[model samples]
Target chain A: MSLQLLFDALSLGGIYAIAALGIALIFGVMQLVNFAHGQFIACAVFALILPSSQAVAELGLGRLPTPLLIPVILGFGAALALLAEAAVFRPLRNAAPVALMVASFALGVALQNLLLVIYGSRPKAVSLWAGLGHPVQIGGAQVPLLQLLVIGAVALILAGLALMLKHSRIGLEMRAAAQDFGMARLLGVRANRVISGAFALSGALAAVVALVMVAQTGVADVRMGGQIMLIAFIATVLGGMGSLAGAVAAGFAIGAASALLQMALPAEARPFRDAFLYGLVILVLLFRPQGLFAPAGAKPRV
Target chain B: MLSQHTIRRRMAASTPLVLALGLLAFVLLATTMGDRATARMATETLIRVTLVAGFWIFVGNSGVVSFGHAAFACVGAYVSAWLTLKPAMKGTLLPGLPDLIAAADWPALPAVLTGGALAALLALVSGAAILRLSGIAASIATFAFLAMVNTIWANWTPVTGGTSSVVGLDRYVTPWVALGWAVAALIAASLYGLSASGLALRATREDEVAASASGIDRYRHRLLAYVLSAFFCGVGGALMGHFIGVINPDAYYLNLTFLMLAMLVVGGIGSLSGAVAGVLALSLAVEGLVRMEKGVTLGATTFALPAGSQEIIIAAAMILVLIFRPAGLLAGREITLPARWVTGRGTTHNGPATDRRET
Candidate 1:
């Protein structure tokens, strides 16, 4: 039972880590918290299905072979994020943080409703890699292969991101931008390119989340990404807003907490798990307003 | 010359009052001239006005974007439901409610007031802790507060009916009732903005370090505004419940949170006038698009977009407005009597001809 629960925690934690990373990436460069990131995830998931109001989803990209399918969906997600940056965010670049946040919220609303119009409000079944759902035994513990894959994928992505941030030129620029955007710009970082790059990577991360979510749930719903996005957003805050590694750590912490709460709660109290989880979030914030793992200077200098 | 200058200054200062009266007039016109459905729509819009006004009380002055005021509304709605529902019905649907609350069948006005008071008390308690946080951290904390409220309201079935709709509200919130609450909210918000505390809060918003250096207690002002704002939002929530004659926890969640924020942001998040204008403009646009989706007659033919196009179009409009005018359509300026009219009087005041940023 404990082993199974561990896998559940790891799987959920991996998904949340990826989602939080996406949010942290964008927030690092731009102070804007993209409320629309969830919508991007939903859009990527829906991209696999032909637009239909029917309960059963007809494969669009889902029908393609694995190699092509992944790139196409990731590309679509990146393109959508880029479009939003150009059309909505770019114009409001100089606006207050509040205004930028609202613009993102508006963009989220538009994208969500657009999906509603095309795909309808119903949750549609998407059978992608159904075979992966079967349990595989590892040292007397039966866990779903998909859970192991998710755990592995999260580790791989985190390692790759660390390497990129350390070695890649754009990643270096992003790191600099995250520290202080103006200083980076003055130091010859291409502002537009860096911002676009951040959005693209963020969008791609969102797409990966979408793929994982679809594979895990075998369903595509417009509202599916919302709850996860909220969690990821919270994780981003709890991890220290702009810190990628911190976000991952907080994501796992939150997921582990959620898993434990679900396990420990009485049957009747089980549904109130989120309330307890979020209450803990408030408690954490009270003690560490700058987040549990914020970088130096992240604290309010008051 | 002094008298004329005073008149112009008074006009500038009374922007919120004038805006409130204008909304009142609009509400009166809609109720008087339109059908029952339009009156319903007007009532809903006025309720939204109250909510947005309440939102501006905290968000505008403090520059903290809250996604949690709807939780207050949820608390207020359920309080009203607990207070007003029949004892028999409450016993059955909300058996977990304490006997005193379940047995009592208070009138709508007192129930609404009680709801607001209860919500204010909750805010007083929560805001003490929450207001200490700043910026996006505060926002996220509020969101967590909201999620916690939603979870409790969803699961505390005995008292709240869990996720199910709590029916049998009195439907006492007519257009006039809503307008009264809205106007009251506007007046209260306006007065607060002009208050010493409000100015201090705005100072903090503009520059926290400078404000703190100047001896402003940012946390106190934020908490005060938060409590006051929650009071009206609670009232608005009670009105919404009575207006619809039904209440559900889901109704007071993210969708409503974003809607209120959208109205505030699209109208301008900085001023009282922006709050009112945002609600009014967005409500009208939504009404128009909803009508269009229902098909509008155009000359010889009826034309309509798809059924769900209204949400998309409205969202698109909000984005476009933000892109072009990020400060909102009002640009954080109040709707004073035109600058030209004041300038034509040929009297200069102690300040600019038109004081746009009063708050």
Candidate 2:
């Protein structure tokens, strides 16, 4: 039971960590909170199923082999992100953060409603890789093979991301842009290239999250991404707005806390877990408005 | 006999008066001449006006975009429902309510005021902590507060009927009543915007360091606006419940938050006139699109937009507005009387006070 609980926490935390990283990546380069990231995730999920207003979703691209399917979905996410950047965000590049945020929100509204038009509002069941649902004995706990894969995937992705950021030329430019965008540009780092790269990376992460969520729930709902997006948004702030490491850590922490709260609280009180979690979030902001991992220099100059 | 200062003030004041009269005209025309549906839309529009204006009191002045005001509205709606619902109905529907509330019944007006008051009290408590943070952190804190309130309200089943809506509310909110409240909100918002605290808050918004250096207590000023803003939001929520005759937690969550924020931003987030204008423009646009979706007979054929296309189009329009005029349609300027119209001269300078950026 203990191992099962630990696995539950890690798997959930892994999902949130990826989502948080997606949000943190965009915010790092362009100070806008992309509310449309949720829509992107939803779109990716919907991409797996053919466009239909019917209750049972037909497997569209999910019929493709795993290797090809992964690339197609990732490409879809990246292309959508790039299109949004060119159309919606590029013009508002110099606008106030509030304006950019609101514009992103409007874009989200458009995308969500568009999905509703195409797929209908009902939640659709799409069984992808049903074999992964079988349980495997890991120590004392019977964990689903999918959960273990999720944990492994999360670790691999994080490690690969860290190494790429540390070693690659584009990664270094991204870091430079995130730290001081104007200075980096003055020093000859291509602005558009870095920003577009960040968006694409963020979008790919969102696609990964979509795959995990669809596999876990075996259901695809238009509103599925909204809850995760909101939680990821909170995690992004709690981790320090622009800090990738902080966002991932915070996301994992929040997921673990949520799982623990679900276990610890009385049955009647379990439904109010989010209230307690959000209340804790407020308290944390009060104590560290700059976020938990915000560098000392991030403190606003008075 | 009027000094230039007094003249400018009156002209500036005419902005809200003109807006109120325009709303009054709309309400009167809709209720008297239009069908029941049109009248209902007018009332709903006025309620939105009250909400957006109330929202403007904090967001416009403090320059802090908050996602939490909808929670205040949710609380206000529930409070009004608890106060005004038939005692017998309350006993069955909300048995967890205190004896006094469960047993006693009240009229709509007092219940609405009580709702607003309770919401204000909530804002005072929450804003005390939230207003201490600045910029985006403050915005995030407000979002958290909204999430906390939503969870509590959605799960507090016995008292709130859980996710199921509280039905059979008295539909006492007529167009006239809504117009009255909307006008009152407009006046209050205008007064607050021109008040010392409002100016101080705006100063803080423009430059926090300078404002604090000038001995402006940013926290206190922001808190004041927040509480005042909550009062109006509460009133608007109560009115909405009375208008729709149903109260649900889902009604005042992210959708409502974004809707209100969209109106505020699209109208121009800098001024009170912008708030009212945004509400009016968006509501009319939405109503028109909804009608189009219902199909209009044009010549020999019926012309109609696809169902659910209104939201998409409106969202697209909002994005276009942001892209083209990021400051909003009004761009932070009030719709006041022109200088020539007021003073009978072609004076280009419309007093510095007319500019939202200036104190």
Q: Candidates' TM-scores?
A: 0.94, 0.95
Error of 1 at B13 (Å): 5.3
Best by DockQ: 2
Q: If you superpose only chain B onto the true chain B, what TM-score does each candidate give?
A: 0.90, 0.91
Tell me how far the alpha carbon of residue A273 in candidate 1 is from the true structure, in angstroms, after superposition.
Answer: 1.4
The candidate that wins on TM-score is 2
* Per-residue C-alpha lDDT of model 1 across residues A265-290, encoded as one tens digit per residue: 99989988888888888788888877
lDDT of 2 by residue, A1-302 (tens): 77888999999999999999999999989898998999999999999999887778999999999989998999999989999999999999998887888888889888888888888889999999899999999898999999999999999999999998889999999999888889999999999999999999999999999999999999999888887888898899889889999999999999898989999999999999989988888788778877888855576676
Pairs with steric clashes in candidate 2? none
lDDT of each: 0.88, 0.90
RMSD of each candidate relative to the true structure: 3.5, 3.3
Candidate 1 stretches greater than 4 Å from native: A300-302, B1-13, B299-301, B336-359
